[model samples]
Target: MLEPILVAARGRIIAGVLGGAAGVVVIVLLVLALTPRAGGGTVLVPDETPAPRWAPPADPPVAAVTPGPYGIAGLAEPAWVARTAKATGIPRRALAAYAGAAMTKASAMPACGLSWTTLAGIGRVESDHGRHGGSTIGADGTATPPIFGPALDGDGVARIPDSDQGAIDGDTKADRAVGPMQLIPQTWRNWHTDANADGREDPQNIDDAVMASANYLCRASTGLDTEAGWRRAITSYNDATTYIDAVARAAEGYRTAADR
Candidate 1:
């Protein structure tokens, strides 16, 4: 009777243990079923926020200007004169010499009566004082020099001939402007002369080109002889409003620089 009772008690303990294990298993299953897993959504984190803009520094350094009479007798401030001389790449000393020569020549043609300021302005507008390197249009197509500058297509991309004969061969499509003043081939042919005494007439030469422009404007037909005539001549020289205005402004500037 005692042995049977002990065996029955051991079976009951085993059943309790099994029941507890089943409860634990069920709890674990419930947790797994209710708890969610990670999904395929993106979590974006920005690296940095933008900063507000600030004002620029005040009292910027001014450029050094050379002192001289730019093209006029002596009106330009030293700094302004220096800048113009440097811009033209014409040495201050050489520019002075040229100014002297120009004054002498200008004196003889008082009837032409244009101010140095105006002449300087014309130079500024015409070719920006030989800064522009131009190309020729030819029969094959538009021919550009390897080093033509940004002003080439001021209004539009000018088509030129690729062949050497384009300009000479009567291809209206092939002829493009040339020289410091951006003179058309026909115009250049008319005005080109040895202004610099270099034996040959070359429009690319700044001194020659500038002198030629002066001559063309001061010529009898252009009527630069009178103030009104000079105005008309300038208008014909450049048809743009801004260009005309700039020439006037530049001429004043040049005159101021030259006088000093």
Candidate 2:
């Protein structure tokens, strides 16, 4: 399973002002804490732009779609989904998965404060919302051909032996991160879910992967409504400071785009 590391370690905060970010500051970095593990999330440096402490992304709508896993896609209204997808440049199917996952998390764990924008940030960094490698997200939320990360063979990446016998990633020699969230086979096997309620839980399906991501994230951090908490949560997901910062930037960009 994806372990949540509570990083209270020491690190440098590279401050930079995002042009056209419209008053957003990122703080709470977990540098070199719990990195190089099996699964991790995947930051920037520029002239310093004076800004206040980091602000977590605004909460997304928590309107319920229905009572079952199948309803996850309907968590957001059609028109709103379309507009927000267009605004944020996120695919409609991917946006639905991310938004629905957030809404579901909001209802399931109200205090976690998991935002769809943050999920989008992850999807963007992980697999481009299941659109990476020329693969497309189907209406059912499954990524065609699926997505897999580079082999973890100790070649410029974390070396993890083949854990699933290639059952999940199709690579028996070494384990590879799979699906939109880029979860390793070991992690997926431990935390996979059936968000689509299709009777079978899959890592390739955007809905399932997103919900699994939400569950893991919420479990990693009790609350993500604050800068320090959000940073810790992202750091737990991926120990690299760059990964945390990149997710923050992507989340801020999504929120900014949605408002515009």
Number of clashing pairs, model 1?
A: 26
- Report the number of the highest-TM-score candidate: 2
For model 2, residues 63-162, the per-residue Cα lDDT tens digits are 5445423557777877778888888889988888888888888888989988888888877766667765567888888888787766766654456788
For each candidate in turn, the TM-score is 0.48, 0.78
Give a tens-digit lDDT track for model 1, residues 53-155. 2111111112224423222223224454356577544334323323432453455565555444455444443333332233322221122231121221222
Candidate 2: residue 76 lDDT (0-100): 80
TM-score, cand. 2 vs. native? 0.78
Q: Can you give the lDDT of residue 256 in candidate 1? A: 47
